[model samples]
Target: MDATQPELKRALGLLSLTLYGLGTIIGAGIYVLVGAVADRSGMSAPLAFLLAGVLAAFTGLSYAELGQRLPEAAGAAAYAREGFKSHWMGRIAGFLTLAVAMVAAASVARGGAGYLLTMIDIPLPIASGGVIVLFTVLACWGVKESVYAAGAMTVIEVGGLLAVIVIGGPALADLGVRLPDIWPADLNGWGGVMGGAFLAFFAFAGFENIVNMAEETQDVGRTLPRAVVLSIIISAVLYMLVILIAVLSVAPDLLAQSDAPLCLVVDCEKSTMAFFAPVALIATLNGVLIEIVLMARVAYGMARRGWLPKLLSDVHAGRRTPLKATLAVGAIVFALTSFVEFQVLAKATSAMLLLVFLVVNLALIRLKQVDPAPHLAFRVPNWAPVAGAFSSILLLGAEVLA
Candidate 1:
């Protein structure tokens, strides 16, 4: 950028961005979807999460290579443009990213409102919209401010997960007996696990969001790739342990029934309700905030590349943020949250994300073919994106047939 132009401040380092990465994947994804996955796979819930994690890793590696190869705010869009050699493809990718981010944020907000209503009576629209408005203000204030809030919230949420593990830890003693149930030996059992993996895949959606922050991150090539890989590995490990504990502590059917699955793990019967309410709220809010920040950067990136209105490309002088873009994205998120049901939003968001991943992985494959010169800081195996693309297609097909 020219000296006169305001650019995104590169204030994020490894720790902050990695925490942000954790926040993106861990919050609403695991918080809400765990039980649903259990509902599908029963005792084999951990396997479903493991399957999802493996698939995500393939795409995550593709993203790491892409992020290092081209560290831009546009992220997938930039990769699409370079790979397809068409400006039009970049615009398509940008809009797809915006749509997925908004829907994902809305779903998380709607889910958060459910948690809020249990604590106190309020209209769903008001509860959800209020959260969106609050976070939009935070995102526009500054990236550092937003990341700090997110990092603190991430720690709190992680603590909540640790609490669940502790409460359910003893359940593992039954592992010797439960081992047989946890593995699927027959076609019927394996089918259930595959179905669960389809839903579990959605929880892995947020790692790609890390790439959108490339412009605002320090040492883009090194930090972005490492953060992507670290977040996926860490989130994957935590997910398996938590899901295993959850399925063991409670019947898969029982855990499946709860809106707050982790709370069920706490075995809370004494208090007002699930003792985990406060932490769940913060986790949900952190997710929505990350989504809003991601969508704004996508809008700003697209605008800067002449795909959207130039006004969206404009940055706030004092805050060094894409103010108008943030406000616009937040408004869209609120509207969707107010109107759409959580299930519909989740399904749509997951489908769009998979479709985008398919395209992005393909973009990486093509780029790899034409631009083979090594990026020494980061590079995935030649077969990585190929597998990523195939897995995406396989999952999409599986979901459709089911």
Candidate 2:
């Protein structure tokens, strides 16, 4: 924590936190993972999404405990610093969290740009930059405005997914419901499934984002944990439902080939709802907007605490937003988008995310022993945190083994 800087305002309510969680959840994962999982699991792509959700839930419990204890910006960093009792561990955790944010912004920016091109005749790069610029400006404006925009975007994105479900409901009903062989009985056979799990982890990226709002949230101890766990559950269910309808409504092989799987679903089983593609695309664009703002805020928070360049700590006087940080984050994301291979970017995201979650879990265990917080708005059962931490470690090992 920067002793010199003024304390960040806590303006986020539970609803805002929920929106932040949801906005973070509905990003490139939904746009990209459907095909990747379909390819890996054949017809059981929905199961891959569910498996990823379960893995994320364990991490979520760990986060709920620590997020309640720490309720500070640089969420993972606070936990790591307090838990490990080491400055370096905190620094590494914060760095990895920022790394995930950068890649997330890049992926969402690229996805938003693609959506814009599909809706219009604009050049892809130019449209992508436009999306980045829009988000950068919003983030530089302030947290309150960004939260409002994020909340609205969450609704629109959820509406898009709901549209898909409503349209595909009849088809889903027609196909007898049964759990497929998604979670292989061998469990050891997940050697092949790890890649898809890594891909699906993208959906859970937004949960850590709540820590960025520590400065802006009201009653950080009470609300942060609620937001963390509830938002993850909400987003997970929504994502699973979207995947279920999307995979079952069409041939899994065909979905594996389609680039815009939801759009393809709409074009096929729900042609009447085809008009909503534009709406869904717009919602995705809004999600990118929220992501860019969050990326900037987290970077700003880290910098204020001396984790990054001090220059990033600058805030616009009128807007009270981290203008310099917003610009810097946008530039970094844009450069990555322009130069790096997407697959490498995605894998890097997965690896960094795993580390961040592991640190958060450790933070909870550490704080429980060192600085026990009481009467938190939320608390995980004692064993849940331990189980969650080990689960994260195992999943990370699996990812590495793959």
Candidate 3:
């Protein structure tokens, strides 16, 4: 290792990394997207989530294999460079990953502001701008601190979702919604479910961001793969449960109409679940924080490798964090939040990640063929990357056509 090269502190253990992954995975997506998916899939929203989870897992397995082989920040870009041996390809993949982070953070912040307005009377711009600034400072403060804070926020947000489940469970029996309705009927119904799954795919987007924190995590090879898979499974279960409760508690058409859909699930008649709104606000902020942390690491990794400006590689001597990259990411996120609407930004985020996932899966397949590591800590089946690449392309097409 070069002594002059900027280095991030390896302060994150397995627990912190797993919690961080869980926090990122269960963040703004479930809080904000359940209603939209319900609109498309009707009573079968849980099926959409389940199918989306399967799609996410396929690509996730590829990432798990790559993480073991090359545990580094700017994960997808690093994989592309090693697999394809093309600087331009690596650069594009890296920047695209960063773009996804920025757009996702901005979308979450915008949604957070909407949640905030339900409790307080403030301008959306002011609220959203305040979220970006606050999270940026937290991100620059220290890696461990930022992740721990996010973990706490994750607990609160998860509790909120659980509360909805418990509250809505009894209603399911009363509504007489048959269990079979959770699955769509025929080819036409399956098409609608698949479209909903494509939209629901956004809910599973944050798991890949975990790989970008490779440099900061303890025991990267041993820990990253486990954390990635565990976080996705946990988030998938929670999303399916929440979606089930949502469809059971309210009419799909009505759930689709509101910005804060979870609140409707908690109390559709009053629509004033005091705890749900604040919890959602926390979830959105947590999403922004995690995205900021991931983007900074990506920028730092790219800069350290000369793919980006060297200045961005600078680590704060005292904090041992990438302050420059953090601020740069913050600026971009703020600009996006200020200019773009939530749905547009969300779709852009999903679309960009689908492309990145395709490249990453292809990279993994290429690496397996050209540079087989017999002693990798983790390895997926030969067909895993192929399936991952195929699913990514299929989902990308579905998203575009939808």
Off by over 4 Å in 1: 1-3, 271-275
Which pairs clash in model 2? 11-216
Location of the lowest summed lDDT over 10 successive residues in candidate 3: 265-274
lDDT per residue (tens digit) for residues 1-402 in model 2: 444555555678999888888888876678656766777665566666777788888878777777666666667777788888888998898888878888877766555544455556876667667777777778777788888888887788788778777877776664465444444555554554665767788767788777678778887877888888888888888888778777777776777776566777777335566566566666656656766777777777678678889988876666767788888878877676665644566667777788788778777776777655666766676677676677667767877776
Candidate 3 per-residue lDDT, tens place, 181-259, comes to 7667787777778778877888899889888888888888889999998999888888877887788778888888888
Residue 235 lDDT, candidate 1, scale 0-100: 86
- lDDT of candidate 1 vs native? 0.86
Q: Write the candidate numbers in order of decreasing TM-score.
A: 1, 3, 2
RMSD of each: 1.7, 2.5, 1.9
Top model number, lDDT = 1
Q: For candidate 1, lDDT tens digit of each residue in 308-345?
A: 89889889999999999999999999888889877678
Q: By TM-score, how accurate is candidate 2?
A: 0.91
**How do the candidates rank by lDDT, highest first?**
1, 3, 2
